[model samples]
Target: MTFISLRNVTTLYSLENVSLDIAEGELIVLLGFTGAGKSTLLNVVAGLTEYQGEVYFNQQNMNGIPTERRDVGYLLQDIYLFPHLNTFDNIAFGLRANSCPADEITEKVEAILALLHIGHLKKRYPKDLSGGEKQRVGLARSLVMEPKILLLDEPLASLDPATARNIRKEFKALHNRLNLTTLYVTHDFTEARELADRIVVIINGELKQSGSAQDIFCQPAPEIQEFIAAAN
Candidate 1:
């Protein structure tokens, strides 16, 4: 089934007319240059920004829905874990805000912690955790909400190369294990190549091309050819 659909969606100033459909459990990557509206597209679907057209989740129109009610999880480049909250509390903040039962919150939080292999850092504050550890916690916090769609905007960008590569593998495994429908945005071609099941390339606020990684690399558009030439 088409899990998320955007029909002629355009974010104010940032994203031009864009339409895309993502199927359930597909890990699609948005690959573009630094200012190509990749993040803008994700924000539109998350309802964090206003757009001109329609966004549908499970065939339901989401024009008037708010971000918190969208059943989407977003993890940005910066780890915004509250400085004062311990790991467990930070992960549970959303559930608490929604008045989920304390016992249910505990169950969900614990399950996510274990799933992300961050159970050992449950008591550590964000200040005490390393960069990679903090990112893992941020991911755990997002997954704890049991979101149907996960939107990640360069979640591994700040890590060292080795750490980033390892996390990419972990993220791929997690997506498969959880059957997550994910839209991951990144400017790095290597990262997109490594993680994407299908890649969509956006340039100058336009979707230039989209296909399997092999197809995209092997038979790129003229613009994409230029991009690859410049990158190499």
Candidate 2:
């Protein structure tokens, strides 16, 4: 049931001795303060950065695999929609790059737009859409690829409070509907508590603790307890 596994994974500078397993269809949130190697860990899983140790996706070693071939859907904190492409083309970009047939690309794009409830925004350009709409379109672009694992790096970080809350609900709903195995990275404890089936805490390049939300909230490590106190 382990869809993604990292064994003693270390990045060049940020991450060290990190190991974890994410189950199939499970949603885990990586919780940490800024510069705590959360993004570096995600980059390692997505094959966007070089790391020492083992990374496995669906039981296959992923050492030398390229990012695109790793079958991962990665959404970074910064939305990187192509300014030249409208919403539909932006979502269809990956399919087109993979040389999917024209009809198939259209079908997939339409389906994702509907699934994300952005069907009406298809004709709008990035400049014309609101922040939430743009974020959803970026999500549609990543989800349309049908990746084995979805890596979301603070996808809600930029939204207003109400919009972020609404999008969080939508993300949970989509995950259930699609049975997505997702690794969501965030620094917000409330967001982590709301979205994670399990929570992994990292600090200064090492994993401190990981457990269910109740366990983490009730019996966190000293460092995590300190963090919680400081945040409050």
Candidate 3:
């Protein structure tokens, strides 16, 4: 069943109709260049930005829901690890904010560190860790909350190619293993092809085309065709 549904959705800054229904357990990628409104799309879903139209997730209508109450986790391209806190505390920040039990926080944070194979870095601070390690902690922090949906806005955009590819691999593996309903925004064609069950194209503040990755790659519309050619 569809986990997140956007119907005839329109935002103030955008001119075209925006609609999408993301299925449960699907990793959907919104592929577009900068200024394509990809970031705005994700912000709207995460309830950080206002928009006009219907949006529902996990059966909850999101028309007027506030960002904090939306239960949507967003991992931005800029990784915001706390400089003062160690990896464990950074990952525990969300749970603590939600007033989770002390014992539970300890258990959850430890499990995440182990799960992401970052157990050894639990005591390390953000300044001490590598770019990839920092990202892993950021991801672990988000996933531990078990939000209804995860929105990633060019999460790997700032990384070196090798680091980005490596992180994306871990993301895909974890996403599939957990069957998490996720929305990923990227301009990287390889990232789109590797991580998405379906791909949505956006251009000039509008959604242009959307379909299975294979459908999009094999049968491209004019705009998409031109864009792909240029990207290549």
- Could you give candidate 2's per-residue lDDT for residues 1-232 as a string of tens digits? 9989999998889998999998999999999888999999989999999999999988999999999899889898988889999999999999999999999999999999988899999999999999899889999999999997889999999899999999999999899888889999998988999999999999889999999989888998899899788777
Per-residue CA lDDT of model 3 for 144-166, tens digit only, reads: 99887888888888789999998
Descending-lDDT candidate ranking: 2, 1, 3
Model 2, 25: alpha-carbon shift in Å?
A: 0.7
Local accuracy by lDDT, each model: 0.91, 0.92, 0.88
Worst 10 residues of 2 by lDDT: 223-232
Q: What value of lDDT does candidate 3 attain over all alpha carbons?
A: 0.88
Q: Residue 173 in candidate 1 has what lDDT?
A: 93
Q: What would the C-alpha RMSD of candidate 3 be, to one decimal place?
A: 1.3
Model 1 residue runs over 4 Å out of place are: none
- Give Cα distance to truth, residue 21, candidate 2, Å: 1.0
Every model's TM-score: 0.97, 0.98, 0.96
In candidate 3, stretches whose alpha carbon ends up further than 4 angstroms from where it belongs are none
List where candidate 2 sits over 4 angstroms from the true fold. none
Separate clash counts for every candidate:
0, 0, 0
- lDDT tens digits, residues 1-232, model 1? 8999989988778788889999999999998878789999989989988889999999999999999899999998796999999999999999999999999999999999988899999999999999899989999989999899999998888889998998889999999999999999987889989999899998888888889999889999999998778767
